[model samples]
Target: MKDSDSPRRRWWHVDPGGALGGLLLAVLSATPSLLPRAALFQGLITAVAFAVGYGVGTAAWLGIRRLVPMRSRPILWIAYGVLWLVAVGALSVLAVAWQNEVRRAVEMPPLDAVDLAGFLLGFLPVVVILIAVGKLNRRVFRALQRMSGTPVALLGTLTALIAGIAATVLVVMFGVDAVYKGLNGAPDAEAVEPSSEFRSAGAGSAIRWEDLGRHGSAFIGGGPTASEITALTGVEAKDPIRVYAGLESAETPEARAQLVVDELERTGAFDRSVLVVATTTGSGWLEAQTVDAIEYLHAGDTAIAAMQYAYTPSWVSFLFDPDAPVESARALFDAVEERWSRLPADDRPELIVYGLSLGAHGGQAVFDGLGDLRSRADGAMFVGSPNGSALWRTLQGARDPGSPVWQPVLADGREVRWISRAGDESLLPGPWSEPRVLYLQHATDPVTWLTPELIWSPPEWLDPSQRADDVSPEMRWIPVVTAVQVGIDMLGGEAVPARHGHNFGDVVTTGWREVAGDAGLDQAAVDRIQEEIEGYAPIQPYLE
Candidate 1:
């Protein structure tokens, strides 16, 4: 080691080990999420990113070492803090500009005090983690150094970098993968086994032996059967029903859509109340809460239909089922649209579209834009939408001029309303008539806001107190760190209480009531419907 005891030649020296330490720790912590994509490209991308951070951190440390006395811990820490501030200021502006570009807005947003606070808050955790990891790295290096017959500087640095990278891959392959496999829980039991045809829609319709899906998920009753419609909702309404047909790697897309349409005809659902055509993710799972809301609001007169596109869980679908969502949505919509258009206009039931998460992305795939949506469907509700959803992104770009991109008001809230909370329906100033839509997005849903730009820039939503009130103040936007934090946030997004986090729950009752645009939803009546929804156990049966 270059001696601090030496005079006149104490030039700033970069410790490659310390510089790369944080990157290694980050990969270690993020192994769980990254393990899903075990590919050469993923590893190369991660390694390149780590190398960049290593170079930047090395430069920062060397610069600080020259200016501050190494012996003075107080001054050194102060310098480190200032360096972080400088890093944030320089990087955050680029982030804001990128988000503006993504939003298709030309206006330049100036860096405010909140931006500074956000970066620093985000940086604090990162620094603590990196420092802790760096110390561990040193311990490992020292252990290696002791084992060596004679210390060699170049070999030691090379060994440490290699060890860090190897550790990352190893953790992903073993530790993270093992945990994910364990958490994958049991696959669909054979009991809820899927089938191609629809069964009877009578009251007290327990999932019979034949009712099991191809994938083993039972088609839990979305609404009471035809006989119970009067007793359950106290109205002469058609029984609400859902037929979820699971698609396997074994089946083609065409057959799946055909089976779904056939199920509609078999159960006599096409001739019933409002027909909702929804898209499911890999698991072919649908949110029961939203179905319950519609069933309650429509007084059991709704037919909610979703066909599973895959047998895998939604997270796995995200990594592997990028095209399955669009494919399934198109097939289902085309089949339903063809059938709906054939029927006389007045005689036909209203057609609507719905989805969430990957399902939401799939829902976006069926339409050209909001105009096409208006022409095709009576109403639609896409909840907890992903940031990359094409339709949602297009609407965001065409929103009201003065409204913030985060909460854009499309067409002055004429056809659509973006509601965060349950009663946020009150936020709408005017009435929504035909082609009504409601985009249910929680203010702090990382699934809806987190993007690739988070790597270098703080997202607009992460700025200051701009996030929803339920979000923690410490959930600030730090380069790289915020990305990891939010990645974890997505896993538990639905764990919070109702009306908060990514859990939309029965609030969708308000969404459906508004989207229906009928005076059928009286304040007192809707309140009772909401209570009925709550009485149904496990409000959110399937979390996206």
Candidate 2:
């Protein structure tokens, strides 16, 4: 009915401020979701559902207040307001304490400034909304009383409100999914290249030197070749060797591993270069940028060898057959280690390992445990490791009791360094010494932190002791709500800047300096290297 025809003013007319406050929250909560990879949408959806639920619950509470006798209406309102503050404050404090302890023990990012008062400040908006909603709810009962005499008017108003809510929900859900689809299939120039001669090889087939870098284009392969590397850095690139034995080349891992080693020997990799054995994701795609970082640090005296185990993209491979990484990783590493050992000890060059994302999961398969990893390779760097990866879990578990997961300063940063950002020296109890293990992770990367346990358990990151500043300080765990939210978090996990997500851009240069300190590359040299490596990314190939 039109306002003129209505018997009384609308429900929102009773408390305009309350309606405005709720509307503002709804907008804020949903706005970030419009961005490419904003994980905050998970919280936005939950807040909307919460508002709907609370609106219903508050209406019922207001109804009870009308039927029951109270000493004073003012006193009852004051009591409820006090209780809400107390409850919110208590929960925030307890959670912060737990989070602080864990972050300290693990050497994760520290949020010491997040005390009780600041914590409460974060929830100030929620408190305001609570007061507003309660007032609106009280007015709802009064509005009901005004409509009781007119049954036709009451039914029409109820129907309109329900329909409005449903329409809003549908719009939000459909809009989010549509945006996700568009981003997922966006085209890129590098992804258009076709494969070269690395597809199939016989038992004793020779390597195709000409077919390297997607048939000499240098724009279609994993890493820069010798000439490209030298040109970019002005350093005498020592053949910038890279060899990959495709899965189609041989029937078994043993054959593939041998093929990889054969190519390595052909390039004289075992003679004088530092050998880096990297494993690719399911798409058989390697991190050519990582290769560029190493070559710049080592002055092009490094050889990188890897083998294709699957032909699909990393995500598809991770979902369908996660174990493919484990199998191929173990096979390739075992084969390379066995052959590298055959060379004379004095002449044997240093061997390092690199694995990022799914490849990191597989590359970890070569070691039985941390002990084995320490004994086997000179150094190793695993970036954006998934929550399911065993090696990541082990070191994280071993960290001190109070450290956070995102940037744990494990065991005084002795043998291992878990880095989320630059300038992590404070996490180190002393100097950057020994075994030289570098783990690059970002607090915003859901792929690294999301797990089944998030539903049943409060994710360690939410403790407020050390989550990234980008994340909401008041984010709370609400069973299935948070699980669904984090599930969405995966979609835009890499949507962050190099310092924040799976996209670890220039930081790799810094990481290499720490892991390969023997290179004697100073800060200026590292900066120069970072710039050179970034230059190749524009034309770098994108694999399936």
- Per-prediction TM-score: 0.66, 0.62
lDDT (Cα) of model 1: 0.61
Candidate 2: which stretches are off by over 4 Å?
A: 1-222, 225-234, 425-429, 534-544
Provide the lDDT at 122 for model 2.
41
Worst 10 residues of 1 by lDDT: 32-41
Measured with C-alpha atoms, the lDDT of residue 120 in candidate 1 is: 46
**What are the per-model C-alpha RMSD values against the true structure?**
10.5, 11.2
- Against the true structure, whose TM-score is highest? 1
Task: Give residue 374's lDDT in candidate 1 (0 to 100).
Answer: 87
lDDT of 2 by residue, 1-544 (tens): 8983344653333332233334333333322211122123323343554455455554455556576566676776677567656644554454455444433433345444534344435444454565566656657856775876687877777787789789998787566435433432222225333233321121233643232223122212445555665565555655455566655557777787888887776667786557888887656666656767887677667777777665555665677578888888888888889889888878897788888888898988778887799888888989878888888898888887777877787767778888777676455768656568888887766668778898798887777786666455445676655665565655555444455545677478778767765255556656777787655533221232
